[model samples]
Target: MALIRKIIKTSSNEHYPFSVPVIENLKELDLEQDIIIFSGENGSGKSTLLEIIALKLNLVRISLDINYSDPEFSDLKAAINAFTVEFSLKPNGFFFRSEDFISYLRYLNKTKVEAEKELKRIETEYREKSAYSKILASMPHKRTLNELDNLYQRNLEEQSHGESYLDFFKSRLRPKNLYLLDEAEVPLSFQNQLTLMVLIKNAVAEGCQFIISTHSPVLMAFPGACIYDFNQEVIKEINYEDIEAVNQLRNFLNDRDRYFKYLFD
Candidate 1:
């Protein structure tokens, strides 16, 4: 079952977020399926709506925090306040945004390195101390490093970007919750994207709900999903075969010569 049943925005504001044509025309979005996808061109309100949903639901973010009070969304604070979210069951979940993924990886690696350095310093500082006292002094740093190692077996930097990203997403999954992802396919290739799509399918089958905003045809092809296209004047549910990106990719591969000739000419 879907965690959130419906979302209603009760404000009429002439602001950047509200002024964005798609958002301006949005009435209320009813989520009837386990996966609700937001698809549109960049600069459309796809990401903006994701932000608002993140704020209203208080979904757990990876390495950054966002609220109606975020300075970047200052103009839309009041508008967000007017949002009303109805739920079948309110469950906790994680929010993943592609832009913040790298920053999160850096944070993990930096913290791990600092802990290792602290352990070394403790060893030197307590050189003259008894073994028990030295162990006591260094316990926290050792535990920190151990926990990080368990969380990510090797340094994230050592892993390919795609591999690391997929592992990170997998490590965060918990059954029976909602997940909000924005362009999560950013760091993945076609094969890795297939892996991601499989992961989503498994999660949904295990009773998790997903709201993903992405452009990847692989992701948009998720079976039984409610795909919302933002390219129109108003956001509307769209058929998978009719999605702009899907047909464009299909056309490009089927007639690359025509495209190349057109471009060269």
Candidate 2:
């Protein structure tokens, strides 16, 4: 499993100053483990850094087949173009951002609606232009329409957001790739986070590398993961137990009554 050895922020003087200040001061990030977890609070630049790395590595965003561009990406692209990357190997993988998951769900619904509309049009055309309809339909292979219709019939939008998100991810993730995830715990429950942990474990076992930025104690607790704390705007490796998310959970669980008393008092 070849990893991204190093990422150094070369030139900081760019058009758009990084919204997250932590990113501007980042001199280098060393990837020493197969599973790297970036743990940080809001505005800590975890996602910002992950996006730059993912784009530099050319990782595709899962569930987004269409070329949908965001104006924010252009700025990031320009910034990442200035960074120096050292990769142990040319990696291939998908970048999963929490925001993209939301957009993907909307895309799924939109696609389903469009497919239904197309189906209706085909039906109407078949009635009016029977001979020509058969030609047009056959040109696409009768199976093409049926296959798309079948997909719409079992549309992922029918499931819960978490379930559909998992389904979409499962459908995209493949073996032997570098998966960069930013705040992946966004749409998942505690149980689903555990499920994702299992999936990541299996993927790593099968030669996949994962670099995730998250605030979930469950995700940060991934077995043998290299956890980088962004609490002070420095990406420094730390023990899992030292992670704020993990410690907060530990403190609350250690004395639930005390936590409640502190909160109420």
Candidate 3:
């Protein structure tokens, strides 16, 4: 059974633009697939829907501490809270907001830097006292730098942003959990998106469920993902090629010169 069977909207308030899409259409939205995607242009309310699903499922994520109380998400919070969910298991997963990634990476970098500073301080203190001092040897932070070196192998800060984001993602993802991701493709290149697609595919095979909101045609092509199109302002399942982003890219790639001529002229 799927973790979240469906979300039934209970509010009729259209006071917020973000709430309009769900209020206008979804009475009882079914989420039977393991991989569900919400795709649409920016500000078309797809990210709001992804947030609604996360709220309704009562997901526990790092983003919860920062975003749940923001005034901008107030409408989505209210709308999703009003909805009822049928669950097969108690939901467990992280909600990864791509927008929050940079701050998260910065925190990691700061943590590593502080750890290094502390280790240096400890090293100097040990040298001043005695190299064989048991007290200094027993300090928990004495070997922190070595431990970090062994654990991370490569510091996330040393890699590209896309690589760091993927590292963050892989560290948090676990099997049989329901993950809610918003605009996950933002930091990725074309090749990295393909790598991420493979990761998603493998995670799904291991009993994980994902609710992703994105405009990337690369991500939209994930095998067997139930894609909901939000362009028309009514949620409907769509094929990979039918996605507007995919269609536009296809058209642009098919004849770039012709498109340039029309665009420029």
- Most lDDT-accurate candidate: 1
Estimate candidate 1's alpha-carbon lDDT, on a 0 to 1 scale: 0.85
Per-residue C-alpha lDDT of model 1 across residues 152-237, encoded as one tens digit per residue: 65667789888998888887778988888999889999999999888888888888899999989989998888999999889899
> Any idea what lDDT model 3 has?
0.76
- Model 2 lDDT tens row, 180-255: 8888889899999898888888888888888899989888888888888887856788998777778788888998
Scored by TM-score, the top model is 1
TM per candidate comes to 0.93, 0.85, 0.85
Give the better candidate number (1 or 2) by TM-score: 1
Best-to-worst order by TM-score is 1, 2, 3
Please give the clash total of every predicted structure, in order: 0, 0, 0
lDDT of 3 by residue, 1-265 (tens): 2578887767566556334664467777788888888888887777776666666667765552475576767755665656777777777887788888778768766767887677777677777676667355545664665665665546778889888777767766687888888999989999988988888888888888888999888888888889988888678888998888898999999999999999899
Which is better, 1 or 3, measured by TM-score?
1
- Report how far residue 185 has shifted in candidate 3, in Å: 1.3
Which residue segments of model 2 deviate by more than 4 Å? 14-19, 62-73, 128-132, 135-154
Global lDDT scores for all candidate models = 0.85, 0.76, 0.76
The TM-score of predicted model 3 comes to 0.85
